[model samples]
Target: MRIKTKGFKKRTSVDEALKILLSHTPLPSIEEIGISRGLNRVLACDILANIDVPPFDRAAMDGYAVRAEDTFGASQTNPIYLKVAGEVKIGEAKEIEVKPNEAIKIATGAPLPKGANAVLMYEYTRELDEEIEVLKPVTPGKNVSFKGEDVKKGEILLKKGRILKPHDIGLLASFGIEKIKVYRRAKVGIISTGDELVNLGEKLSEGKIYESNSYMLASLVKTSNSIPERKGIVKDNKEEIKKAIKEALSNDVIIITGGTSVGKRDLVPEIIAEIGKILVHGISLRPGEPTGFGVIEDKIIFMLPGNPVACFVAFETLIRPMLQKMQGLSLMAYSHYLVAKGILKRKIPSEIGRRDFVRVKFDGKYVEPIRVSGAGILSTLVRADGFVIVPENLEGFEEGEEVEVRLFHNYFPAP
Candidate 1:
């Protein structure tokens, strides 16, 4: 079946579709009780370093801190031994200053003693007469990490919009940063509509399926590091649909799945027309032919296809970006894109004016095409590595044609 949208242009261009999506009201500002240890949450602002890393000059190894000139010509055959004046423990300092032929024993991360310019590892010497023998000659400033060596004060350690990682956390801790400021989470509302859809754990009946799309969409929203509020499922009645949509519009963004495809009972677009402008009734795309974009009282409303794989693909391609934008992130977090060759030969039909994203597997660095079928076949998505973009102007991919594949999940980093 083809798109049934009438008047003011029928076949939607990718650019037009994007422009239409952007035409909707920007997501509203919301207040949320934020949490720490955020993995993929977009940063609210730039993080500047208040303290220099290392804080002070410290020894890098368990060794002796001595004047370099005293052991300048020390060798393995005839070593120089300095009198062990005292010992410095890690995170402690000594009051005594080192003079000629005098050394202070220091452990790893210990502050350097006064008048000491170099450190000699314990492996390079032996102990005799309460003095350590240095086999290797020393140079000035060797084996010592200076204050601000790794990072300087006032340096922008982690930039704004960066999704926090384990390494980022360690870097923050190195600067004595115990807590940080992050942006408030995006508040999203979900509404699932269908008389045939029943709640989970209920007894199954003919022509009835559990309402899994709402839960799946909610999980995806959570995975994107946002808050998902379930608005519950409504029946096929138009008045109830309008009321449910209006209620959800009170949030930052709203997502309505099912009741989107063009059937006698699919009143999603009609109901959207009653409440607000229908920016896009049917996107020129595959699997999600029933997809639509619109607005309801300043909140963005997206009608996604009822099928599982279709909804999943639409969320990755469409809904994910909007949520990131609302969170102040410039790009989609936790997503990667790259180009690879098709391994197996197959042909798939795409809409005349719409682009198609076909799933394929990674054969080494290149992708091998798989038997991608209807959106109802959930296993097709499980077996795929990523999806390829088939341009609307050209025919579908051939056996060995290279294409751009947008990854669905992590495991393959951008090449």
Candidate 2:
């Protein structure tokens, strides 16, 4: 899987390229992390409950614990009365027994006393000195949460490869799971190449642009729950680029922006072919046609475009999914990305045999496309709300046509 000296003439489809890249990428390693810090981390193995949730049969309502038979035939017109026993407080293990014709005042979540089979809510009864009146009858086990009712001991609570949420953390804590095994986050090394590029805080000279793709890619990696190692800037020289690539190979994934296009300084593909294998040199996609991918020493390398907007699109569509795959997530889970439908404000022209991602501003009712010829226009991405994809087989979208828009924000505009 190496690129020839003549370069790639036929571009690989987006789906086929992703299949090849993922087939080579392996699941990340596992580590034992404290449950307190497990948010967004993928579980490495199935998590079984070691103990029953709630731990015991407890009260589900604030009421009197009594035998269901005692309240039989009791009603508002003609009520039954019982002797009041001691009160039961929550978290108390003190033993208290209920005798026939007797009731114990129990609070919500308080354990039911021995000889008690049901709870009569306080609303259904009233106290008269040393006696309690039951206006309603309760069946056995009514308002009582039996032991192991919420979660039985040894029950599988969470499955492997599941992304942990706040509720999952609480459940683990409930079972006294202080630490858990989770897949280690993929460490991605971001390298920005080209002598024409300058880092932030440096004044831009003629024919130089401030480096933004590295920072953009870093944020993208962070949002995907991965570690981003910004390798700073590198010149287009083969030795310098090769040295940086070698250094970045230590990470689990390598991402190089710039030097991926067909030009004299575009040496990323050539250098990668020399050190390792270039699995994909180009993809059939608009705004990111120069996007490439390869492997160096078993680590996957993504060759992204230099333009900030193109870089952002390529990362979100291609690299982000790859990162998720490496962390043990299934392709089905990838569909959870925020997507909404909106009416197109205008027609979007596209060429056949190439997929296009057009940035659009969705103002609840319609999605207006941001028209820009240069892929380097970064402001359009900032001002736009989301993007709409046009398939390679279609020409474009018609005005007022409903289309699916992948949102940058998690929420859709209110109607």
Candidate 3:
């Protein structure tokens, strides 16, 4: 009982393909939250300030909160004098006020005493027993940080879903914020499907490769602030694959790798057909040609290509963005820079009917192809900075012509 898509046509653009995934209620919810200092959590809501930053009028200079008029015409040669009422230390505050022709000593960050409108720097003053001589003119409202200057009460400090970086914490601490609400990370499910795949510790048999795709996928998910629920390796057997997909769908987005391509064990697509609807198969893309999508019990089942590089690239480029969206991040175009030097001049090979992503690396001044052979070479992917997608209308890229590259970046910092 399989509902497989046959005579595959590449109608799926990357964006259109992703939208089809949402036909079911496949997104993770935001209710699951646990606190751990919230160091790196995305904000669940915009934070409005309960208190003003600085809390009161404060001195922005270490000098005197002065009656600016009293310092009028003051000069080094002909200094104007005003009685020094008192000093306002950096931390302490008082109820003192100043009348006309008066001033008070103030340090930087000290709250301004009542009736004082400006500050004069310490370098512009000379002291006397009963008064201080102002050697420089002071203007009204100079060197003062007004109450709520840095931020006002009830102002939106951080928008909902903004990731809390280190500096974000400092702003909260400075404003006396001890806690905040942030969106919990969405949980993701990672499963590897293939009889040829073995555990990492196991010695490689003649045709068996150690299970690295699962670990790689898990790490990628974790880096994006998503929790990865690893369901380990499932053999290519139909029923086994079905059970794995069933369990993974229980978590969040289900990512199944290995049995996606057409092979003896490429039964993952077949199994999903029994349980769900295959949205798209045989994407018109390189390195990840066998990519497919389905919905299983309201969960997304992404059958990523089995090759390690293909799996790695597909997750980072295609899947990570969707996860970012689930965490409340508004989807937007991000720029990925590609720096490379061209070595050869030739036409690129691609049908005008499909888009091809060509892997390239930096050669000092320009990008160069790291893999002239094909997408199966994971090692060459390690050398690439980004990809130049060759469109189907164009047979190939002219070797010497500069090209646009879709760079792959670790958008989330590596854990």
* Candidate with best TM-score: 2
* Residues 1-68 of candidate 2: C-alpha lDDT, one tens digit per residue: 23434555898888888889889888678899999999999999999999987688889999999999
Error of 1 at 338 (Å): 6.1
Of the pair 1 and 2, which is ahead by lDDT? 2
lDDT of each: 0.75, 0.86, 0.74
lDDT of 1 by residue, 12-46 (tens): 66557766676564742433322346555555667
| Model 2 superposed RMSD (Cα) | 3.0
Task: Output the lDDT of residue 100, model 3.
Answer: 76
TM-score result, candidate 2: 0.93
Residue range with the least summed lDDT across 10 consecutive positions in model 1: 1-10
Per-residue lDDT of model 3, residues 252-356, tens digit only: 788888878666568888887778888877775666768887877767778898887777656755677777667767554332243333443345567766656
